[model samples]
Target: MKLQPNLLLRLGFRQNARLRHFTGVGTSLVYREYGDPQKVIVRREDVIPKLKDDQVLVRMLAAPVNPADINTVQGVYAVKPQLPSVPGNEGVGEVVEVGKNIESELQPGNYVIPRVNAFGTWRTHVVTTSSEIIKIPSDVDIAMAATIAVNPGTAYRMLKDFSPLNSGDTVIQNGANSAVGQAVIQIAATLGVKTINVVRDRPAISVLKEHLTKLGATVVVTENELRKSEEVKSLPQPKLALNCVSGQSGTEILRKLSPHGVMVTYGGMSRQPVTVPVGAFIFNNVTLRGFWMTHWNKEHFSHPKRHQMLNELFQLAKTGGLQPPNHSLVPFSDYHIALKNAMPREGMLCKKQILIF
Candidate 1:
């Protein structure tokens, strides 16, 4: 018996005329080592990836160059893959085709974002299962939509999990300049919660404070002020604190929390271990926990929950409550320039840079 067209599609295929005349190939960015951007290898038109029976084809739209994405390439993240692997962790794409037997809640032309592990997204397209893709709202801009996966997802999960936030309650966090930190400030504001943000003292402290305050932060304190703030005693003691910078910075955040409050640590961007005072654990009843986006996505939440969470985020974005920060857009053809521009920088200029395909 001959295989049906449906069966052929199910086995990773489409009915293009080229399917009969030529081989399909996809181009991707691959990195083999931990070093500078020059170390990255751009392999174009390598192989046109085929979808499995349960998978769909996503035409790449836009993807951001996040710190974690860079870290993965550097082999610093906990989830390092084998050498010469594709390098993007999150991206937004449109479903161009679906396998015949694929039963996806997602449809072609719909914008979808996915957090697939080590399956390089710095490509013209990606082939992944329906389980990995989250349908995005129609109104969300595809460029801003590209940033929805890791940073925003981390901020949302941490705020929701660390403690129950109420109106007028305040949360403290370091790395207030990070993308996730900014999202936390905005989301907390939208929820009627307040934020006490901490950052290193820069030359333009006033300007930085104003920027954060505009983002809904109740208070913006330098690291030095955080330690000496007799003012914090009068304010509502923070019930939740987020620490991406570790070491003494983390300890200072813990010191400011209310009794029995929790501090959730996500990243160690400071390259320091969080040091906690013995008194915080023994007397204050404080709990210290860690959050890793990969761990939470893989173990705690199911695929459906991930989709639902993103849907809620989109609703917030559409309402103008959870707006994304200013972004620099680079075309896919200029990916080399974009890659160079994405290097770790010290000063403030562009907050987030996204690669537009």
Candidate 2:
């Protein structure tokens, strides 16, 4: 007297409210077409099919709503998934079941995260190939694990790859209030590197400055202050400049770079092109570059550096050296609330939103 898969899922959804453990059914925020996430993404529940020989069943614990996730849903990001896709780029989950033929060391109860981008992490459960996910240290905070692979990884790599920064070296950057910027401050502090953090002015500028300063920013200044402040002018010119906000902000940081310094542009929060002065390149020999974590992962798929970076970040989390960005945890059932808070609005400082399953 075996029941059908759909019927089994229906029963599981009705009977198991806590979701403390996997029950062969899960919900997902799926978008059938490219549009605004709020207008297109909908929650749906379905049966969890049995695993293939190479697949593993993961009970998702938590996932963050990153800006990239929103851009991917709107069909504007560099990486677009096929329509009718789930939208999530990073998350942490627990292994609930493993296919019998799995040859790797993965087993039930191990915590894992997708090794590749666009793995559809905004779901309650996932069945993915063994190679698609990688195990992470189980002791780290779930929120930190859920958010680590993107922002912190970006900060770490930009510091290491673009230049040979040693202790006491200075790095300057715009968008200091962003998650990646905060990570840069903390990671740089650990290495004894100094950071000049530039952020937009707000009504509560003092509070923002305090927050970033606590995170290890040597100095926090607004865009206008970056231009007029004698303090900024007096410090040693940075060898590395990190630009996430382009337009005038980008040029401001570039002007502060030392001769033969490097500037890495990873994002354009202002949606404006980066403007560089001719003298900065010709006279100063400054270099301009870009970094995309997804592309880096693709190029270094099996590189040992990837594992080393992850382990170092995990250690930082355990020791409180790296902290999860300011965030709000919204229950997975209240996904609409999370979306509303996460969506960008004029003059609004949105906290990172993590969905707890």
Candidate 3:
């Protein structure tokens, strides 16, 4: 067929690669320096980038206000974005235009999420390579899609990579109310693995326990309970422990691990170091390791296993093996509320604040 000028305008969702078109530009939450998000990030309207031969243009639909995204802006995260960069690190976007010679399935209107870190996903649009965007089912929830890369992937990897778990094996983790913790409960339930989830003691504790129970947490306990409750002693020795709240929450969960089991530390939500009894190291023979999804992605970007794992996670969401995180949407223009909501207030912080552009 003869090629038409500006082909991107004619294609519904499968626009031909040769048609280059522009949707003008977009607004981005940009920061020129590392500082508080409220002080560093500002509204900036800029021209959308022209597509390069190997690139595809994506229109961002939604991006979540994750703590890591905030920490990166504050210069606290281990991975910092170069100055004068956008702040979002993970989100869901749609292909709106593509380079004339781009060779991939990322045609106009296709749904995709960034396949790599530091792609600056917190904006209205982005110009990224076809190979850097992971294709997702077009019909998936945009909010769920935006938030998937970090939490679910971390939970999935921690569940599978750190230890060898069988159908009946037990796993223990702290921060059971966190996004990753919720994911761990659901994913473990799907795999028939039992989970003993530990959360902080708080008012209306039963409400939180009921919520996690619905997601299939085999047992939900408070820090005090995990440490001293007789109920905790009745369960089998957990073969694996996942720790994100690295203080007392981690300490108690680590003590419950079966001898020779592994404890994987992924975060320090409490801003405290992980400490265990000397006896744990000397007598229990427990192994301690850490996982960073960013490092893992850097190592596996080109590997088929990366794609396979992402695909499996998406499939799990599609089939209800997972439930989307509790999220409150904020318009791109009104991002102040999003930032405020993302912060811990009155000691509660599990709800996600998402930016919808």
lDDT (Cα atoms) of all candidates against the true structure? 0.78, 0.88, 0.84
lDDT of 2 by residue, 1-357 (tens): 122346445646332334323345688999999888899999888788766777888878899999989889889999988878989999999887677788658987789998988999889889898888989988888899999999999999999999999898899999989899999999999999999999888888998999999998998999989978887777788999999998889999999999999999999999999999999989999999999999999897768999999999999999999999999989999988888899886554569999987
Stretches of model 3 off by over 4 angstroms after superposition: 1-20
Cα lDDT of model 3 by residue, 1-357, tens digit: 122345433432243345545646577888999988888789888776556777788878888988888888989999886789988888998877778778656677788888878888778778878778888888787887888889999999999898899998899999889999999999999999999999887887998999999999999998877777665677788999999989877888898999998999999988999998888999999999999999999999878978888888888889989887888988888898899789765547457998887
lDDT of 1 by residue, 179-212 (tens): 8988999888988888889988877889888888
Please give the lDDT score at residue 179 for candidate 1.
Answer: 86
Candidate 1: Cα lDDT at 274: 87
Scanning candidate 1 in windows of ten residues, the lowest lDDT window is: 17-26
* Positional deviation of residue 34's Cα in model 3 after best superposition, in angstroms: 1.7
RMSD of each: 5.6, 4.7, 4.0
| lDDT of model 1 at position 224 | 91
Using lDDT, rank the candidates from best to worst.
2, 3, 1
In lDDT terms, which candidate is top? 2
List ranges where model 2 is wrong by over 4 Å.
1-23
Clashing pairs in 1: 25-47, 25-48, 26-47, 26-48
Backbone clashes in model 2, listed as residue pairs: none
